[model samples]
Each structure stands twice: as structure tokens, then as C-alpha cells.
Target: MSQTTQPLHFARQPHPSPVAPEQRAELLRNPGFGRVFTDHMATIRYTEGKGWHDAKIEPRGPIPMDPAAAVLHYAQEIFEGLKAYRTADGGATLFRPEENARRFQKSAERLAMPILPEALFLEALDQVVSIDRDWIPEGDGSLYLRPFMFANEAFLGVRPSSEYLFIVIASSVGAYFKTQADAVSVWVSENYTRAAPGGTGAAKCGGNYAASLVAQAEASRNGCDQVVFLDAVERRWIEELGGMNVFFLFEDGSMTTPPLGGTILPGITRASVLALAKDKGITVREEPYSLDQWRADAASGRLREAFACGTAAVLTPIGTVKGRDGEFTIGNGRSGARTEELRNTLVDIQRGRAADPHSWVHKVF
Candidate 1:
């Protein structure tokens, strides 16, 4: 594990009503995604003076909170998503989780909340996965871990909460897409913006995602799988999708993605993809890519491929990019060779089938 040693103190709680084996088996047969959870969760409390305390692993249930909780009103919350893979040795491992921890702290800082120390973050993750190791599904399935923090203070005034709570929960996830081969279609959202200059676009906060729902709905109506958002200022430069980062492949054997100008989430998968591209001796650029550039390239066959990356989907090939003026199709409405190669390289390292020269994978046990 590429993590600093941290002592995890756990208070175990027996689930009063854990799912029966038959029920769990039924769900496991087709676990869809993020619908069902394990028997327990990990939690830790924080206050202004005491800092983080009462760290414990508790039953999977609700946390009693005042109606006026800070998170409910002011929406001061942050979260991280990563997976624990079931290795061929029957052991479990987490993929580059320390990166997620660092991003969590950055998100908290953006929300004006106390940073959950790296030690605490890793400990909570270890505790939950350790106690619920059986929940780590086999085959291509995984135990999706969600670590989140929110202000629990009940006061109506919202400067920054003095009280906060951090929790880690695990769920059995089958696949982000039913079939990995299906090329995803995207709708270009011209009006709705995911983030603005000096806004919380970079932060993995609820508000940023909430604002993109309308655009996502439009995509669904247009028979598209996802929505592509633009920068709030120019509205010409491509930003990202509703829940994933975007990337474009050029004919010169180079790739480009929108730079993280404090207006985009620096995805762990995005960083990992760039590293893998460099390993393959491919040129990668993190620059401002616009819709016009993509359109022109597609028309001239210079843009060979496009894809989206995130912890959930890993890598999603973009089949079509549709907007008001018109729509441009890429690679015959199917996954391109370059897109498949990139996806395979990532999955190989993640599943331990290939050597992780970058040392991105971390063993959980």
C-alpha cells in the first residue's frame, strides 16, 4: 500500500437486519450499480476545538441530524469514489486511493471545511473494507467505496460549520455500463454550465452535479447517454461531461484535454490516463479544446477518437457529439481502436493483469 501507516480504531456494530444470503445472492446476480449496500459503515465526528474524534464502524443506517443541518441548507459537503478490486489470489486491493484522499481534502478546503487528515481518511477506508471484505464482489464486479464529509451543524447561519461528520460506505457495483462495447452518445449543452470562473466546478460537491441535471435530462431526451458542458465564460471551450472529464484524440498521434483552470475537477482517472499515454510514448496536451476544433477535426478525419474518464466509468468512448447547429459522428458510431487500447491498458493495470510501472494500484490486504 502506498499510504502512511495510520492506526485505525474501530467500534464494531452488529447489523440488526443484514440482508439474508438468498437476497444478497439475487442482487449479486445483477447488481446493476450503487443500489444496494453492505451491512456496516465507518464514521468519525469532528468539532471546532476537538478536531476529529469518536471514530467508529457502525451499522448501515441513518445519522440523526437537526432539520437545519448545515449540509441540508448551505450544502457544505464533499465526497470521493474509488473501488476495491477482488484479486485473483482472493485478496482485495484499492486503486490509487491516496490520490482520492488528497482530492477530498482539496474539496473540503474549497468548501471552507476542516480538512480531514490523510491518516483519518485512510483509516476509515481500511476499517470499512476490512469489516465488510466479503462484500467485495468477484469476477468483474467490485465493492464501490464512497467516502464523504458534510457539515452537521444545525445553526441557520452559514459562514462555515463548526461541527462536521465524515463517513465511508461501501456498495456492490456490477458495471457502469451494461455492455462495455456500447459507444456512448453525448448531447452538447449550450446553455447550462457546470462550473464558472472562481466557482466550485473543481470541487466534487453536490451543487456542481445538481446544476448539471437539467442538461443531463436534455441529453436523455435526445437519446444521448450523457451531456457535455462548456465553460461559463466563453461557452466555446469544452469543459467536461455531467459526471466525467473529456478527452480528444488528434490525427498527429497526440491527445488533448481541457486544462484544469480551477474550473474542472482533476479526476484521478484522468491523471492516470495521461501517465499511461506518456508510457506508450504518445504525446498528450492539457490545453483548452473547443467544439469548433473537434468538429473541424472530425470533418477532416484528424480527430480519430474521443472519450470520457472517471472513477465510475473508467473510460467511455464518445460515439457522437450533438449540438444545436448539427451533430458530428466519430469512428462509424462505435468505439475506436485508440479508445479501446487506452481502456485496456487502464483495466490491465487495475486488475493486476499488467505490471503497474507507475505503482498506481494499492493492496488492501
Candidate 2:
């Protein structure tokens, strides 16, 4: 799909009842994931014939939806997640926002939704970040941005909706995990699989996540922090966690992660970690890793470290893997040296403490 010819011009409609500085400060002190929201939100409407229009920054509140909305019935929706970081110089920036935009476009295509122009996507990010700059917390915290689109047309038909709503909202969030040193344990879900061939596995859609909730609940019930899914067909190859991609670090300074063969979400953080590893002269491979092989390697001391990567968790070390077969500890059940090194490197680049050779940091101030 191609971009619309008309340029987007966002109209400003400030929130009348913004939070006071002291109250906002209290919320920012411990924003905790998606618990806290900013004062305003960015929105744009799209019609089949009129294209995207009526771009505006408005107050954060409930969206009016018809009881028979298309999204409510058919689930034509997609979203993107990225964060705005607080720089060392008292400024703010985004980490590879264009990448998120491109992924959003891909997701829209897979779900038969309207393709939002990349320029407009970036502009939406800028508009929200600029308006809620103070919502960005200091130190280890940042403003988490969630841009999503859904079918708003009130219809009962099983086709693409004629009307859609695209919105960008911001939340001040602290680290996902309480401590970086504490590695998370994962449970292997033998009864469920995440995606299959020709499925919406690679797309950042809501349905994919909604379907994984049961398995995630299973993980929590099993005394685990996360769930790891295997391939659908053979049910042997390791796919990924519920929302994050998996990685295996070998003792020989080599890294391997499941290949993206239409069965895995191409995470921006995953790509960044691969690039960072290669830059450090570490060998990185994208290939299928079997669950049996993972167990054997960890047992035999071949696998040195394992971690999951995503926007929210960043890079989290997978210290232990528990399954129906058995349980095994990886690298003393703690975060390894390479995992710590790579995590620090990425955080440094995001926070402007190190040189950005790839120009991934977009300054918003």
C-alpha cells in the first residue's frame, strides 16, 4: 500500500483539567508499567474515501464506541510499543521510532486495515511526546507510548470496516522488573502454541496477544514468571515467549535465536541486540532452536546464557526453564556476563551515555 498524498495537519485541543505538578510528580515517582497515564492523547480518524483526517491532541478519556462496532466483533486492530527516554542532558528522545512506524504499517496490512503513512506516524509520536514531555520520568524511568488503531464502524458484516480510529497514548512507566539482577523463570507450554504458518504471528495485532492469555495464566499458575511457546507443527522448535523473542548465548561467544520464518514477531529490541552483539565481535545466528536441544545444551553446559527481548522488558535473562519433562538451570540461575553487558550497552545508547553509531536515537526536545 502507498501513502496518501494529502499531508496531515494536527489540530491542537489541550486538556482543560491537567494534573497539578505535585500530583503528577507523585504519580511519576512510581508509575509501574501501564498503571499511570499522562494528561492528553493524540488521535486521528480515517475513512475509506477521505483517508486519514482530523488529527488532534485531546484529553485522555473513554472513547465512544458502538455496541456493534466492527472491532468488537471481528477484531481488526494493531498496535506498536516504544519508549521516550530521559537523556543525561535533561532532554528527551525516542528509540528507533521509525522502526515502530514501519512495523505498524506491516501490521495494518496483515489485518486488512488502512496503512498509515510513516511520516504521519512519526508526527503522531512527536506530537504526543512534545505535549506530555513532563510525564517522562527521570533516571531509569521513561514515558511508554502505545499507538493503536481499530475498526470503529458499526457493522455486523465480516469485512474491513469503513471507518477506523488511530490513537496514541502515553504512560509514565518504571522498569518492568523490580530488579535487573534477578532473572525471570519461564514455563514451557506444551499444550498451546503461539502461531503457525500463514498466521498473524509476525503481525503486532491484538488477537495474537489475546489468544496467549490462557497460556500466560498457565505460566503464572505454575509458579513461573513467563511462558515460552514452541512451534506449532512439530512442537519441538523453540519459538518465543508470550510477547518477547528468545535468545541463546553459547559458551564459545556465539548467540542463536529462532529464525523469523513467518512464525515470530520481528521485535525492534531483538534486532538491536543482534546488531549490538555483532558490533562487539560476537557471532550471532538466526536459526531454529529445539526445546530438546535447549534442555540438553543447558544440562551439558553448552548454553551459557538465555534471555528474552522486547520493548517493555528490554533484555531479560532467562535463568531457568521448567517444563513437563523436567526443570533445568542456566548459567547458575542468574544473569550472565554477556547478558549484562549487552543490556547495559543498549541502555547506554538509549540514554545518550554512549555514541549512537546507527543514529537510532531521535531527540524530541
Candidate 3:
């Protein structure tokens, strides 16, 4: 985790056969989510004694991997997701990328992976965005940035790998949800748990996501947009969605979210929403919320709104929730006014269309 080198200097290797402008434009018209990629990517190597070195921004392609790479066997991999938006000023900006960098460090620590320097992390993202700026879509679209690392040492071992690879890739994406629904329906998962105490649930690793796939599929089968996981111990306390954090808004103009107790991802957007809520004079609390209480409060008209927040979706209102026990709807089963207000406020700042009192947006171009 210690850096023996001064700083990373990325070498450039432009794409020999970059996508033609007409084809790129056609592709950008519907880049979807993570399906479309830019022309180049940022990469760096880490060794046991050399720290980080051989950094480069090269043509987008694959790196050959040995069959027994440590990452393949041990699953020591971490990743981060953020976005770069095209502002009205004809430039691109990133939303709280430094926060992503810090969280990446924390994820690395939890996964027993190498701690990439925060500055180097930021620089890597900047280089990737700077080179692939054209890939950024217009309107509500954005360039999704994915920063990842994995153990590459070609050995079958139980301990940490001495060699690793870090890379950054970008994709042009539209709305996360394919549908234009005002709110998304959710399914409560009682049979499966997303995380437990002293586990890697808080980490942004591949394993946690891979484990959630089955539950997610269950949600899909149940006719829901996302799956909500409860606490492993009680199986009733509301924890989070498969990939997002949860928030409960009360009629008393207050909101509460599950506290970060090493079982949640500690989302960057979640923190920003809390700060924005406080700024708007809404009382915000970080505490435990039980599923039973959520149902009761919703039924009693105390819970005005509920939403999920994450880097990808930003803020998605939870209109209806269904489980084996029963089903419940939040506040008319539509996006609440307060929810819209909060999302608009956050999006305005992200798109550089409003005041940035918190300085969360970083200009990349």
C-alpha cells in the first residue's frame, strides 16, 4: 500500500483504428449503460517492491491473463463507478471523483488489495476522461467511468498477490433504467442476505456483486426492479438494495438511512444526499430501520417517501415494495415531491447548472 515511487506518469498509446465519426455518433445515440466503450483506457502496474509503475493510457483492449492468476482463484478484485457529464459550457466535469478515489482505497483495504494512491487514482481517471472526452454523450447522458484493480500474479496462492494491475475505462451511458417510470418497484429478500458483520460487504469488489446476481434474478422473477436485502442477523432490519443505499423520508420532514457499520458500501452519493438534505433544512438521521417499521410507517402514512441512492442510479424512488409477507406502497406509489426536489438539486449541481456550494463537481475538460 505504501508508494515507493514519486508519482505515476502515464504513457500514451492512441488507437490506431479509432471509430469513425459517423459510426461513433450512431453508437453514442444509444450507448445504453456499460455496453459501449471509448477508444482508450488507462492502465498501471503494481509489484510487491516497486509500488506503482509503468503507467499508460493506451488503446482500449484486453490484457492476457494466466489461467491461475491470483484474481481468478482468490477473487481479490475491486472496482469503482462514477460519471463525467458534459456541461453547458462545452466542457466535461466529474462528480466527486476524489471521493471515489478515497472509497477505492477503502475497498482495496477491505479486499486485502493494494491501496492505490488517491492522487494517482484521480490522475488515472483524468487521463482517461481527457482522452475520451468525445465519448461523453449529450443531454442527460454521461460517460460512465470504471476504475478497477485485480491481482494478476499467475499463481494459485491463499495469500495476497505480489503483482497487480489497475485500469480505468469509460463508457457512454444513458439513463440507468430503461423504462421512464417515475418510481421503481422493489422486492424484499428474506431468504438471502447481502452482507454480515466483519465481512467484505462494504467493499466495492466483484464478489459482493456476483453474489447478489441470484437475488437480483429473484427480484426480476418477482416482477420488481431491484431487490432489497435485510440485516443478516435479524432478517427484518432494512439494510440496502443489491447495489444501492436506502433512504426513508418521513412526513415530519426528516429522513433516515441505515448507518454505516462495516456492512454497507458507504456510498458517495448517499453522503452527498445527506449533506444536501441538511442544507435544505431537512433533518437527516443515520440509524437502523427495520422492515416491519417501514411497512407500519407506510401504512400509517408516516413514511412519505423511500428511495435508493448510488453512483449509477443517483436517486431512484421506491414506489412499491413486495415480499412474501405482503406488499406496500410508499406515498401514492409515485415519485414524491421531496424526492424530485432532492434529485433535481443534486442533478443540477452535477450538470453545472446550479450553485456548487459543496464543490462536489470536478471539471475534467
Candidate 4:
């Protein structure tokens, strides 16, 4: 991530018609994930010659875009998802937002877009969260933050756009899954793959997700909560689930997930879980695990439990797995003991309920 010579100053533009306290309270009471947004959003612009400028914390609304914008045709967009949690003292905190900024830089580099300085990216988040602190829900809730950038240059050429827009918007969310269940079922996608070798799978870009929608829909049709994608080449190695990383626990007290060579995303939550597991004296491996191996191990009682981890679904136990051939259950089809232990440890640190030795939490308000 690049460093700006001078700190970018954000100009505040209060909403002309802000939501009343009563209405906002009502919305916050039942915000539902990604349904209700905060009153304001943060924005910054970039041009070829001039660097990132026009920083502002303005009212949440639409952006007037040109029909001929490059993003419209070429789909040059990247985004990051993090959350702001309300602490016990009514203060708000962010969980390793700088890491998100650094990942955003890597995503930009992959998409051939200019990198916004990490400081600037963070300032935008702070601005949005600080100004809309009221939207942060209490008790196991958070304000979900979406930071995204898109090529905005009104040119139809095949080259990368010369201009871009970076914006951060917040939503008061309760939980990602409506059921808020401990365990979820997954469908092994036989027909669809998320990304190919040397593709944008590692980047947090819209194109990667757009490509996964069909596979996700297939999972839903198969009566599962999410889709588990296999390697694009062999179509047998377990790569990842739709939007989250998967992990396996063995009876020998070892944990394994797919190695992030190139195809799978390097998830922040996945990394944190690995570190936490190691601290608890559990062995963690990033070795390749095939679908055949997974099924065999789960059946032979070698593999105890498996779970998916991400920002949205912090850690959900994988109770059952279904595919074209058959379905299998993992460890009594319930949340496993080790899975719950690690999730509680991670969430405690994230929510400021426990001591953070890694200093991952960043208090924004």
C-alpha cells in the first residue's frame, strides 16, 4: 500500500434530510443484513494526472454515472467487506481495517487500477463510521462496511479507465443467515467452478462474484445453504465455498484448508482462525484435499468436523455435504466442540469482549 505525502482531508456534508432518531432506532432494531443503510457514506475520486482527491463524507445516495462508463462495459470493480461493532461502553470499533486496505490495494493492482494509499482508504472508513455511530447496533450486532472502487471514466475503449471512484457505505446488520443457525449444508458444485488458474479469483472483484452467482443458485436449488467449488482443472480438489473459506478438523486434532496458491481468496478470517488454532496447540495445514478424500475421511471418522469462515459468516459449521452422487454428514451434523471454541475465541477478540494479544481491533469511535 502506498503512502500519501499529505494526509487527505475529508469534507463533511451533512444529510439534508437525515433519518429521525425514532425511525433510525426502529431500523436499527431489525436492520437485517444489507437491508438498511446508514445515513451517510464516504467517497474519494481519482484521475490519471491528479491522484486521489475530492474526499467527502456525504449523504448516502446514488452516484450519477455515464452510460459509456468503462465499468459499464468492462466491469472494472473491486470491493471489501468489514464491520464496525459497538463496544460495551457504546463505542464503535473496527476489526483489522488496515488489513482490508492492504487487500484492497492488491485487488486494485490485479485489476490494473491505481492504488489508493492505505491511510486514505482507512480515513474514509473512519469518516463513515464516526459520523454514523448511531447506526451501530447493540449486543452481537454490527454496522457492515462496504468499500468499493469502480472505473468511472466515460470511455468505451478496451484499455483501463483513466478515472475511478472509491466509496464506503455502511449497513446496520443483525446476521447474514436468517435462521442464524450454527450449522449449514453445502452442495458440491459439479458443473460450475469459481475461478481458473491465473484468474481474478484471488482479487476481491465483482467479476469473480458475478461468475459464482450461477453456482450459488445451483446450490440453493440443491436444497443447500452454499456451494462448494472444486479446482477448475481437476474438478475434484476442494477449493472453497461460495464467498467463504472451508476448513477440516481431523480426529488427530489437525486442521486443514486449501492452500492459497492462486485460485482461492486469502481470507482474513481464515488466516486469523489458523493463528488462533495454533495458539491452542492445534496443527494447521494448507495442503490440497480432494473431494474423494474429504468424503472418505468423514465416513471413516477421521475427519470430525468442517466449517466455513468469512466476514459475513464468521464461522458456520458444515453439518452436511451433498453432490450429484450422494450426501454425507460431518460429526453428528451439529456444531462441533473445537469449531465452537475457535469461533468464540475469534469473535470475542473481534467484539472487544476478550483480550486481544494481536491488537487486531481498531476502535473507530
Candidate 5:
């Protein structure tokens, strides 16, 4: 696939009936995740031979689709999530949006979907954010951006679609957890598995999330906040949480997370945490840790902390682990010092409070 070097110019189609400032302020006061959306959305269409075209920022509304659309039958879809933060200088910026664009391309290729050019992806994000800058909430709140692509072709016969639609939308969101110190409990899903050796585990697609819904429900029923899945084959080695990646902090000032082979989603937040930890002279390992070892370490005071990482749930402490084998607490069932430090460091860099040494934050305004 050939990549476009030049930036794609997006057409502007302002929304006629946008939310009033008063109403928008009211909604932004407590904008939960994925609940309230901005007035407009950015879109681009792609044909097999024509490449990507008809790029515009239009109003937010329901999309017309055929009953037998390719996405309905085969589910050829991919999406990426990131946030636009309100900086201290009274401006808006995005955290590692290019990384999301690259991941979106990898997901598209895995699903046999046309890779939306990286330049177009970034342009779409900037266009949406620039128009909906007011939707970005103040303080700890942010504007979450969701970029997605799906097969829109009407006819489908168990093959890839010839046409696709790429769209970007913005939403005002609060923190995933109510407070930074509120740790969550996890339930091990022995009956369900998230991904296999040659599956779409690594792809940020809707199907992967759809498959984990049942396990998540099980976790809720078990009185836990999230569900953890182990390897599909042995069911002993820990893979990841329902949607987030897991990390373990040892008592010896070291950390370990399951290596990314083909069954784990390479998260941007996870990578940032690993890099930050390494920069602080903390020993980080990407080796597989089994559930048995996790339990034993927790019981023997070998494991100091455990947490989950993702775009939505930035860095949440895992206080308890429950399964049919029994339940156990990790490090006195509280957020550890290292976990809090890493989370604060990352959040500071994101909100423009700390120096961006790696140039991860992209200023849009």
C-alpha cells in the first residue's frame, strides 16, 4: 500500500444546530465516558481504486447502512481512542495521536480493510478537535477522540468490502475511575479466553471487545470491577485484563508485563509507562508471569503492586484478584508508591505540567 506524503485538505461543513454554550457547559460538568458527544464529526470515504476521498467535517448523527452491509455480516471494523487535554496555558493538545494512527493502520491491515493514510488520520483528528475545542472540559476532564473505520459496502459474501467509511468524533469525558486512589478488584475468567495464538487479539477492533463482553459481565456478577484472562492454551499464564494491559511491580524495584507476541494489544499508555520506568532507572521486564506466581508472590510479599493500563483507564491499581481457585489481595490491597508515582508522572506530562522530554504531546491550538 502506497502512503500519501502530503496532508489531505479536509472540507469544512459546520453544524447549523450546535449545542448552546449554557447546555454544553452543563453537560461538560460531569461528562461520563462516551456519553455526550460534540456537535460535528469528521468523515472520509474510500473506494478500492479511487483511494480515500470526500473528506469533510459534518454534523453528528446516525449513519445510513444496508441491512446486509459487509460490516453487519463480516464485521470488518477498526477503531482508535485517545484524548485531547486542556493544557495549563489555556490551549488544547493531543497525547500521542500519531501512535494511535499507526495502530489504526495495523488494525486495518489485519482486518483486510484499506489503511487510511496516516496524514489523513491526523488531519481528521485535528479538524475535529479544532472545531470542538470548546467541548474539551476544564480541570482533570478531557475531550476523548474516537477514530474508526468500517466496511460500508452493501453487498457482502464472506469477503472484504470494496468501500469503507472512516470517521472521527469527539466526546467530553471525566476520569475512568471516580478518584485516582480508588483501586479496583479483578476476577479471573477461567471459562472464557480473550485471544488465541493467531487471532485478532493485537488489533484494536470492535470484535475483540465484543468477545470480551461476556467475561466482563461475569466479572460484574462476581462482584469485581474487571475480568482478567489467561492464555487460551494453558490457562495459567496471564495475558491481560478485559480491555487493559496488566503490569506487576516486584519488591526488588523491578517490573514485568507479558510480552507482546500476537495475543496482546500494544497499548500507548503501557509503552509510555515502560519508557518512564526505564528512564527512572527501574528494571523493567517483558516476560510472561503466570497466575500461580502472581498469587504466590502476593502471599509471600514478593509482589509490591499490580495495575492495568489503557487509553480509557490510564493507570488503575489492581487490589484484589479473584477466581475459582480463591481470592487474594495484592500488597495490603492498596495502591503502592511506585504505581502512584508512575501514574502521576504520566498524567503530569499529559496535562503539560511536566516537561515533555520525548515530545509525546501534540499541541493543536
Candidate 6:
């Protein structure tokens, strides 16, 4: 699939009455991530007979769909998350968005849906971000972009629907971590599993996150910020968090994380971190690190730090890991040096402060 752009005409409509500047400023003061939205969104449609067509950039508002939509009943859906950065030179750029497009196609195939062409997906995202460039905030803020597709055909059968809709929305978001980037407490989910061996665990489908909400709630009740799901079969190996991937840095200058065992999301951030680690001459291992090993290593002073990475939180240090039995503290209960180094390096590259050695940044304008 070529990355060249095709001139797809968009039907535009300015908001009849956009939020006043003062009101918008007040909201942007904190933004609080994903709570506030821009005034416009991009949309497109696809059908069995007609491929992806009727692409348009329209006003930001509610969508009109039938009550018996396939998404509501059968839950056939997929989505992707990426950010648009406001460069120091006032240029707008996207972070590895082509990777997101490829992942979205994989997600569609897993959900038994039609794959959106790479060119079409990238064009939609570019148009949306460019139109809403004013909404991109300053000082570590971003224009959070969500591109999702759902089965829209009004059908009741258990088969895949013939009609589908893909839409991209932009939201002005502040830091995902409200305060300082402190370590978050994580809980071990004993009663539930996020995915099975031969399940849709790796796909970025809505159902996988939906299934994790309860476990997340359980973690919250236990005074934790996120839930760590164990392997479905053994229930001993660490898998991933509710929405991010996990990593561990050892005292011997080596690091490791759980391997992609067909039950974990292949996060773009995770892949980038691995590449960065290799470039930095750090020995990295992708293997199954179990809970017992985590506790043993922490006690033995071999495990130095633990953190989770994703598009939303960029990077967050893990302070404590608590389960039914007890809790384990890591790195003096704070973000460690190695963790901060990696986080800062990645963020610097992303926010245009440092050179993007990986050529991961894509200029949107």
C-alpha cells in the first residue's frame, strides 16, 4: 500500500456556534485528557458492494444510526489511538501513524471486517488533525485522535454486517497523569482474565477493553490505579495492564518484558522502546516473566524498576504490585533512573526537542 495521498473531497460544515474563546480557554487550562472535544470530526463509510467511499470531513456532533445497529447488538468494532504534536516551529506532526494504520488493518481482519486502505486511513487522520490544528495545546499537551470503525448495518443475525462506518475525532488533551509522573499502584486480578490463548487478545477491538473494565474496577476498589492480568492458563505469568504494556529493568543492565504470546496487544510504544533499548546498547529480552520471579527478583535486588507504556500515558512508573496475598514495592517506591531516562528520551523525540533517530515522526501539514 502506497503512502501517497489521493485528493478525497470532504464536505465541511463549520459549527453553527462554536464554544467561545473564554470558555475554550477555561477548559484548556487543564483539559484533563479526553474530556473535551474539538468542533469537527472526519467520517467515511463502507459497504459490501461499494468499498470505502463517501469520505468527508464534517461538523463534530452526534451520529445518527438505527437502534438495531450491528455494533450495538453483535459488537463488531475496532479502533486506534495516536497523537498529533505541535512542533516548536508551529508545524503539526503525527507519531508513527502509519504503524497505527497497519495495526488498525490487523484489528479489522481479526474482527472479521473489511480492511481500510492505508492511504485512506492516513488521509482521514491528516485532514482531521489539520482542520483542528488550533485545538492542539502547548507545553506537553496534544491533539488526541481516535479513529474507530463499527458495524452499522441494522441486522439481527449473528454474522458480520454488510455496512460499516469509520470516524476520526480529535480532542484537546492535557497530561494523562494529572499530577507529577509518580508511580501508580497495580493490583493482580485473580478472578478474571483479560484474554485466552486463542482469543482476540492481540486485536485492538472494543470488546477486549470492555472485558477489562470490571477487573479495572476491582483494582480501583483495592486502591490501585491499574490492573495486571495474569496468563489465562497458568495464572502466574504477567501479561499486561488494562490498557498498556509492562516492562522490567534489571540491576545487571538488562531488561525484559512478557513476550507476545498471542494474548497481548502489540503496542507501538512497546516496539519503539525495544528499538531504543537496542540502540542504547542495552541487552533486551522478550520472554515470559512470571509473578514469582518478579517477587523473587525484587527481593534479591535484581529487578530495579517497572513501568507501563502506552499512547495515553506515554510512560508511568509502577510503585507497588498488590495481590490477594500482599504487596511488593519496587525501586524504593519511586520512578527509577533507567525508567526516567527512557521516558525522557522517548518524549524528547516525540515533542521535537531531540532528533528523531528512528524517523518515526510524520509531518501532517
What Cα-based lDDT does every candidate model obtain? 0.87, 0.93, 0.92, 0.92, 0.92, 0.90
Least accurate 10 contiguous residues by lDDT in model 4: 1-10
lDDT of 6: 0.90
Residue 81's C-alpha lDDT in candidate 2? 96
Q: Which of the two candidates, 1 or 3, achieves a greater TM-score against the reference? A: 3
Return the top candidate by lDDT: 2
Of the candidates numbered 2 and 5, which has the greater lDDT value?
2
lDDT value for candidate 2? Answer: 0.93
Give per-model TM-scores: 0.96, 0.98, 0.98, 0.98, 0.98, 0.96
Q: Flag the better candidate by TM-score, 3 or 6.
A: 3
For model 6, residues 261-343, the per-residue Cα lDDT tens digits are 78999999999999999989999999999999998998888999999999998889998999998999987989999999999
Task: Work out candidate 4's RMSD over C-alphas.
Answer: 1.2
Give the winner by lDDT: 5 or 6: 5
Candidate 3 has an lDDT of 0.92
- What's the distance in Å from true for residue 296, model 3? 0.9
User: Each model's number of backbone clashes?
Assistant: 0, 0, 0, 0, 0, 0
TM-score, predicted candidate 1 vs. hidden true structure: 0.96
**What ranges in model 2 sit over 4 Å off?**
178-181
* lDDT for position 125 in model 2: 91
For model 1, how does the per-residue alpha-carbon lDDT over 247-324 read when each residue is reduced to its tens digit?
898778999999998899999999999999998989999999888988898889988899999989899899888988
